[model samples]
Target chain A: MTTLYHQPLDTASRCVRLTLSEYGISTHLEVEKLWERRRAFLLLNPAASVPVLKTDDDLVLVGAGPISAYLSESREDRGAPLMPVDLAARAEVRRLMDWALVLMEHDVTGVLTHEKALKRSIPADHGGGAPDTAAMRISRDNLTWHLDYLDHLLSTRDWLAGERISLADLAFAAAVSSLDYLGEIAWAERSACKLWYARVKSRPSFTPLLEERVSGVIPPAHYDDPDF
Target chain B: MTTLYHQPLDTASRCVRLTLSEYGISTHLEVEKLWERRRAFLLLNPAASVPVLKTDDDLVLVGAGPISAYLSESREDRGAPLMPVDLAARAEVRRLMDWALVLMEHDVTGVLTHEKALKRSIPADHGGGAPDTAAMRISRDNLTWHLDYLDHLLSTRDWLAGERISLADLAFAAAVSSLDYLGEIAWAERSACKLWYARVKSRPSFTPLLEERVSGVIPPAHYDDPDF
Candidate 1:
C-alpha cells in the first residue's frame, strides 16, 4: 500500500484521495500538519504542498495532477477512466482540470484557505500574520464571476465539465467542498452550481472527505448532508 | 491548418506554439491583443486567457495544457514525444506541468505580465490605472524562492523536471522567457537554471518565439541571444 501525506482540509489532497478511492487503490492516510514543516515532510515535497504519495515502489509522487494521473494509470481495472481516451475529449478534460486548479482553486478556494486556515496555522517563523485585505476583497468579488461561469457551464452540461464524470469534476468538487466548509459559497445565488455540487457531494468516495474533521475548525452543518 | 490565437510575448501561448511546431503541425498564427477583450475572442475563451487553438475540425482547445495534450494525441509522429508513454513518467511530467501552470506561472509570470504588459495595455473600460503595487511587490519577492527551488531541481536533472524533455520543460521555459523579456530574472543567482534555459532557448522550435516582438514593449537586448 502507498502512503498519502496530507492535511484533512486541503482540497488538493482530498481531490487525490477521491481519485485514488475511485481507482480502488487504498493508501495509508497520514495527516500532516503542514504548518509544522517537519524536515521529513520537506524532503518529500520541496514546494511544501500536498498530498504527496509514496508509492509501493518508494517512488514519491507530488501534486494532485500527478497523483491522480498515476493512480488512473496504475489501477485501470476499477471505476470509469479518470481521463478520456479520445483526443478531443481528453483535451476538454485536461482543460477543465486546469481550470479547476488554476482558476477556481486560485481565485476562490485560495482566498478562503488563506483567510481562514493559513492565518491560523502558520508557525511563528512562517510569518503568521493577518491575511491581505485587498487580495481577499478581490477574491470575494471574483467569486461571483466564477460562480456565474460555473452556472453557465452547468446549464449546458450535466457535470461542471464534460459529459462524463472525470478527475476534473472531482477536483472542482473538492475545491467547492472546502469553500463550503468555510461557509464561503454563495449557495443561494448559484442554484445550478449548488445542485451540481450536491450530486458530487453524495458520491460514496466523497464520504470520507465529508467526514474529515480539521482540528480547531468546525465544518458547516450542511457539509455532510447530501441533500444540501 | 489549425489557427492559434496567441500573443508572441505570452509564454503559455508560446508553449503551445512550440508543441505545434515540434509536431510539424502548421498553424496560422493570429496575434491577439489579449487585453482588448474582443467579442469573438471572449466567445472562444471566457476566461480571456490566451493560447486558444481552433482545430481544423472546428473544435477549440483552451489553455496550454489542453492544446499541448491535444497536439500530442493528434500528432502520432514528428519530434520527440512530448509526453511519456510510461505511466509513471507521464504522471511525473504532468505534475511538473501543473507546477508550471499553477505554481510558477501564477506567482511569477502572472505578476510580470500584469505589471509589465497588462497595466500598460489596460483599456479604458477595464478601469485602466496604475498596477497594483503591493501585488507586484509580493510577486517579485516570491520569485526568488521559486527560482531557488528551480535551481535546486535543475542541479540534479538536465530538464526542469523528468529525464527527457517534456511539456514541463517547455512550460517552465515559456514562463521563464516571459519573465526574461521583462528583464526580471536574476541570472547570476540562478546559474544552473540559466544553463538549462539556454539549451531550451536554443532549440529550433524556440527561435521563432525569441524573435517575436510585442508592439509596445521591447525585450532585453540579450533576449534573443541563446547564450544569455
Candidate 2:
C-alpha cells in the first residue's frame, strides 16, 4: 500500500494524482495544509511541501519530481511509462515538466493560487489576507504569456510534449486545471490549448481531479465540465 | 561530440559541467549571453534557458533537469551513476536535486545572480539596471535560512543526500559555488556546510568550474580554494 500526502489544489500534488491515476496505481490520499507546516509532514519531507509519497515499506519520496521518477522506476510493471522510450523524446518531456512544475509555477500558477485561493482560505496571521491586486495582475499577465506559448505548442503537436500523452501533459494539465478552477485562464482566446485540455479532461485519470476542491474556495461554473 | 550551450555563472550550467566531467565525458562548451535571448539559441530551446546539451546527432536537450537525466541514462557506462543504485536512495538524490534546482534557485541563487552578476553584464535595455537592494536583502536572508538548513543536514550526513557523493552534492555545489563567487555566502557562520563544500570542491570535477569566470564578475580571494 502507498499513501500520498498532498493538497487537492496544489499543482504538483494534482500532477502526481493524475500520474498515479493514469498508471492505474491505487494509493491513499492525505490532504496537507501547506501553510501550517505540520511537524509530522516536515518529518516526512523536510522541504515541508506536499505531494510526498510513502511506500508501505516506509520509503518516502518528496516533491513531484522525485515521486514521479520513483513511480516510473519502481512501478513500471504496473502500467506503461509516463515518459517516452526514446532518449531525446524523454528529454523533451522532462524539459516541459520543468517548464510546468518550476517555471510556470514560479511565474503564474503558484502566484495566482497563493494570491486568490490560498490567501482567502488561510488565517491572516499565517500569511493570508486580501489578494494583492498587483500580484494578481502580474500573475494573470504571466498566465497569458504562458497560455499563448502553450497554444503555439498544442497547435503543432497532439500533446504538450509530443506524439503520445506523457507526464509533461499531466503536469501542464494540472497547472491549467488549477488556473481554470480559479477562473484565471482566458480559454476562449486560446482555442488550441482549450481543445487539447478538453482532450486531457476526457481521460479517466482527470475525472477524480475535476471533482476535487479546496475548502472555502469555489471554482468556476464550468470548471468540471469536460466539454467546456 | 557533445556541445553544451551554457553561461559560466549559471548554476544549472555549472551542474551540467560538473556532471559531464565527473562522468569523464569530454564535451565542447559554448557561452551563451542569456539576457540577449539569441534567436538561434531560442530555436534550440524555446524556453530560451541555458545549459542546453546538443548531441552529435543534433538532438537538443534543454535545462539542467532534463539534460542531467539524459546524460545519466545514456552515459551510465562511462562512469559510476552519480545517484545510488537503491531506489530509495535515488529518490533522496532526486529530492535534493529539486531542492537545489528549483527551490534554492527560486529563493536565493537566481535572485542574487541576476542582481549582482547578470545585471552588471547585460545592457540596461535588456532588463538590466541597478541592483535592487531590496531584492538582494531578501535573497541574502533566504541564503542564511538555506545555509542553516544545509549546515543541519551536513552535520549528520556526509553529503547533502546521503553517505556517498551523488549528483545532489554536485547540484548544490553548483549553487553554492556561484554564490560564493559573488561573495554572497557568510561561510564563517556555517562551519558544517563550509566543511561539506570544501569536500565537494576537492573533487576533480569541481576544479574546472572554479576556474570558469563570468565576463565582468570577480570572485573573492577564497572562492576557488579547496582548503579554505
Candidate 3:
C-alpha cells in the first residue's frame, strides 16, 4: 500500500487526496503539520512540504504538482484518465492545473490557509502575529476575480478545461474547497461557480474532504454540502 | 515556428527558453513586462505571466510549467529528450522541476527580482516601491541554503534529477541565472554549485540569456562568464 502524508486543510494536500481517491488508490493517510519540519519528514522531502506520497514500491513523491502528474501519468489504466490524450486538450488541462497551483493557490488558498489555520499555531515573532487583516483583504479581493474567472470558464464548458472532468477540475475544486472551508467563498452571487462546486462536492472523492476538521476553526455549514 | 512571450530577466521565462533551445525549437521571442498587464498580453494569458508559448497551431500556453510540459511531450524526437521515458525516472525529473518552479523561484529568485528589478518599476500603491532590504536579506539568506542544497544534490548526481542533464537542470539554471545577473549569486564559496552552473551556462541555450539587458540594471562583470 502507498502512504500519503498530508494536512487535512492544506489545499495542495487536498488535491492529491482527490486525485488518489479518484484513481481508487488506497493509501495510508498520515497528517503532517509541515511547519514542524520533522527530521524524518525532511529526509523524506527536503522541502518539507506535503502531500508526500510514498508508493508501494517505495518511491517518495513530494509536492502536489509532481505527485499528481506522476500518479496520472504512471498509472494509465488504473483510474479515470484525468489528463486528456489529445495534445491540444492535454495542454489545456495542464494549463488550468498550473493556474490552480500557481495563481489560485497563491492568491487565494495560500492566504486563507495561513490566515485561518497556520496563524494560530505559529509564534508571533516568526511573522505569524495576529492574522494580517490587510493581507487577508487582498487575498479576498483577488478571490472575487478568481471566482468570476471560473464562472466565465464554466459558462462555456462543463469543466474547467472542457466538456468532461479532468485534473483541472479537481485542482480548482481543491483550491475553492479550502477557501470555502474558511467561509470565504460567497456562493450566492457566483452561481456558476457554486453550481460547479456542487458537482465536484458530490463526487465520492470529495467525501473525505468534507469530513476533515481543524481544531478551533469551524467551516461554514454549507461547505461540505452537495446541494447548497 | 512557435512564439515565446517572455521577460529577459524573468526566471521562469528563461527556463522555457532553455527548454526550447535544448529541443532546437525555433521561437520568436517577445519580451513581456508582466506588471504592466497589457490588454493584449492579458488576452493571451489572463494570468499575465511570462513564458507563454503560442504554438504554430494557435494553441496558447500561458505558464512556464505548462509550456515546458507541452514542448517536451509534443516533440519527443525533435531534440535530446529532456524528460526520461521510464516512469520512475520521469517522476523524479518532474519532482525536481516542480522544486525549481515552486520553492526555488518563490524563496530566492522571486524575492531577489522583486527587490532588485521589479521594485524600480511599479508604484508604491501596487506593492512596489523602494527595495525592501529586509526581504532582500531574507532572500539572500535563503539563497545560501538553496545553493548548498544544489551542491549536496550534485555531490551524488551529475545533474539534478540524474546522471544526464534534464529539464530540472535547465529549470534550476534558469532560476539561478536570473539571480546571477543581479550579482546575487555568491559563487566562490559555493565552488560545487559554481562548477555545476558553469556546465549549464556554457550551453548554446544560455548564450541568449547572457546578451539580455534590462534598461537600468547592470549584471555583474562575471555574470555571463561561463568559466567564472
Candidate 4:
C-alpha cells in the first residue's frame, strides 16, 4: 500500500526507487509532474517537489533525504543494510550520500536535467526554452571535477563509502543514471568511475531506471549496458 | 579533543554549533575562511565547506547533516533527543530539517548569505560585487513564502516537526538567525514566524550565535535581544 510520487528523470525519485527496491519494498509508483504544481501534490508536499512517499496508513514522507532515512530505519536486517550500523561508518555513508544526492545534484545532474530534458518537456512561457549552454558548460566543468573526486574515491575503496555496496553508491547511481539518460556522461575518459558505475547499475534494483525512457530524450547506447 | 571548523555567519555551521551545544558536546570552534579554500581544509574535505567536525580520534565528519546524525546517534539517553526515537517522527523531523537547511537555503538563506555577507568578505575577483539587488529581492520573496509555511506549521504543532523541539527548529533558527543578523527579515508582517523565531533564539544554545560578529558587517540593533 505504500505509494511513491515520483518522476522518470528526477534524481531524488530515482534514488528513492533504488532504495525501495533494495529493501524489497515494492510500492505503486505515481509520476508527479512537478512543473504543473498540482494542488493535491502541493497538499502532500508544499515544496512541490518529487519523490514524496505515502505509507500504507497515509503517513507521508517528503524529499529524498527523509524518505531514504525512513526506508533505511524500517529496513530491519533486510538484505545488506544500505547504511552501516557502526555510527562512524554510518556517518561516512551519510557523507557520501549527501555529496552525491545534494552536492552533485545541485551542481551536475539537476542542472543537466533542467537544461537538457526538463526544458524540452515544458512550454516556453513557463521559463522553458532552448537549453542554456552556459549552464550546461558549467555543469560539465563541475561534472569533471566531481568525477575526479569519485574516481579518487573508487581507486581507494571497493565502493563509494566502503567495502560493500551502500546507499552512497545507489544515490550516485541514481544521479548518474539520469545524466546517462540524457547522454551526458563521458564514460571512456573515466575508467575507474565507469567500472564503479557499471557495478552499481548491474544491481537488480537499477533495472527499472535503465529501462526507463523519457519520450523526447534518448539515452546513450552504453547507458543500459552493465558491462559497458 | 574535538574541534569544529566553521565560519561565523555560515548557516550550516551555526546549525551544527547549536546542535553540539544542545547535546552538551563541546568542541574547540575554529573559524574557516571558506573563500580562501585552505589547502589543509581541502585535505580534510575536498568539498571545501565549513561545519566540518574533527572528532577526538581524528575522524573528520563533513557537512552539517552527517554531523547532526552522528551526534544524535551517539546521544543515547541524553537530554530530550533533538531527533525523536520514533522512526516516523524522525522522518517528519528529517523532512523539516531538509526543508530548512536545503530547500529554504537554496531559495532563501543561502542566497542572501552569498549576496550580502559572503560577497562582502571575498575579493571582488572571486565573484564578489555590490549585492545583487535582483537576487536579494528574489530571496526576500522566497523568504516571505517560507515564513508563511513556517507560520502555518507552527499554528498546528508545538514545534516545527511535532509536539517537542527537534533539529528542525534548530536548523530553521540557524538559517533565520543569519538572515536576522543581516537585518533582512520583515518581523512585523509575520507574527507567528517571529514568535517561533523568538522561542528558538531564546534557547541557551543560541547564545554563541547571537554573540558572533564578523569584522565589517554589523547585526541589527535587535539581533541579540532574546525578547525582541
Question: Ten-residue segment with the worst summed lDDT in candidate 3 chain B?
Answer: B71-80
Recovered share of real interface contacts in candidate 2: 0.98
| Tens-digit lDDT track of model 2 for A34-133 | 7898888888887789889888888888988888888787775665468777778888888888899988998899988888788887889999999899
What TM-score should be assigned to candidate 4?
0.98
Q: Model 2: per-residue lDDT, tens digit, B1-228? A: 999999787789999999999888899999998778899998998777889999888898898888888888786566557878777888988998888888899889989999998898789999888999999999888888788888888888988888888889999999999999999888888889888999999989999988877778899999989998
For model 3, how does the per-residue alpha-carbon lDDT over B59-101 read when each residue is reduced to its tens digit? Answer: 8987777888888888766653888877788878888888787
Write the candidate numbers in order of decreasing TM-score. Answer: 4, 3, 2, 1
lDDT accuracy of residue B223 in candidate 1: 92
Local accuracy by lDDT, each model: 0.81, 0.88, 0.86, 0.89
Computed on C-alphas against the true complex, the DockQ of each candidate is 0.68, 0.88, 0.72, 0.87
The 10-residue segment with the lowest total lDDT in model 1 chain A: A71-80
Mark the regions of model 1 whose C-alpha exceeds 4 Å error after superposition.
Answer: A76-80, A123-137, A186-189, B76-80, B124-138, B186-190
Cα lDDT, model 1, residue B109: 77
- Name the docking class for model 3: medium
Full-model lDDT, candidate 3: 0.86
The TM-score between candidate 2 and the true structure equals: 0.95
* Best-matching candidate per lDDT: 4
Which of candidates 1 and 2 reaches a greater TM-score?
2
> What lDDT is reached at residue A114 by model 2?
88
Q: What interface root-mean-square deviation (Å) does model 4 yield?
A: 0.8
Compose the digit string of candidate 4's lDDT tens values, residues A23-50.
8888999988787889999999999988
Model 1 lDDT per residue over A145-206, tens place: 87788789899998755777888789888888887887788787888998889988888988
